[model samples]
Target: MQKQSKKGFTLVEIMIVVVIIGLLAAMAIPAFQKVRAASQKSAITNNLRQLASAADQYFLEYGIETITSAKLADADVGYLKAFKAVATESYPTDIESGTDIEATDVPTAVSADNTLTIDF
Candidate 1:
C-alpha cells in the first residue's frame, strides 16, 4: 500500500487563519480611519487659510471686512472661486461653526465672534 500525503490545510488551521486575519483587519481599520480624519482636518485648515488670505485681499481692494456667500457667488476673485470649487457646491456658511472644518474653536485666521467663518 502507498502512503498518502496531506496536501490541504485542516479545518482548524483554516479557521485559525481566518480569525487572525479578522483580528488584524479590525485593528488596522480604526487606525486608518483616525489618520484619514486627521488628514481631512488638516486639509480643511489649509483651505480656510487660503480663503482667509483671499478674503483679506478682497477687503483691502474693496474696503469690506467680510466675504459672504452671496458676495463670493457674485465675485470673480480667485480665492472665492477656489473656495466654491473646492467646497463642491456646499459653500461654508460659518467660518467658525466647526460643522465641517473639524476644529473645536474658530481658527486663528478669524475672530471668535465671526459667524461666516471659512469652514471646510
Candidate 2:
C-alpha cells in the first residue's frame, strides 16, 4: 500500500486565513479613508491658494479689489490658465479682498458639514 499526502490546506486552515485577512482589512480600511480625506483637503487647500494668488496678481496688475472666480480662471485674460476642482465643491462667483473663499458641498470625507473655507 502507498501512503497518500495532503497537497492543499485543510478547511480549518483556510478559514483561519480568511479570518486573518478580514481582520487586516478591517484594520486598514479606516486608516486608508483618513489618509484619503487628508489628501483631498490638502489638494483643495492648494487650489484655494492658487486662486488667491491669481486674484492678488490680477489686483496688482489691474488695480481691482474684486473679481469673479470665473474671471480669474479665464484662459485669455485671466491669471490662471485654468482652475480645477478637487472634489464636489463650489467656488464663490465673487471674490473680494479681505474676504474668505469657501467651497461648498464638499465631500463628507473632508468635512462634516460639507464645506471648506480659507482666508485670503
The C-alpha TM-scores of every prediction are: 0.62, 0.91
lDDT of each: 0.53, 0.86
Candidate 1 residue pairs that clash: 94-117, 95-116, 95-117, 95-118, 96-117
lDDT per residue (tens digit) for residues 7-28 in model 2: 9999999999999999999999
* Model 2 poorest ten-residue lDDT run: 77-86
Estimate, for each residue in 21-120, the C-alpha lDDT of model 1 and write its tens digit: 9999999998996676555445656766665555566667887545554454355555465443222213344332223322334332332432223443
- Compare the candidates by lDDT and give the number of the best one: 2
Give me candidate 1's TM-score against the actual structure: 0.62
Candidate 2 stretches greater than 4 Å from native: none
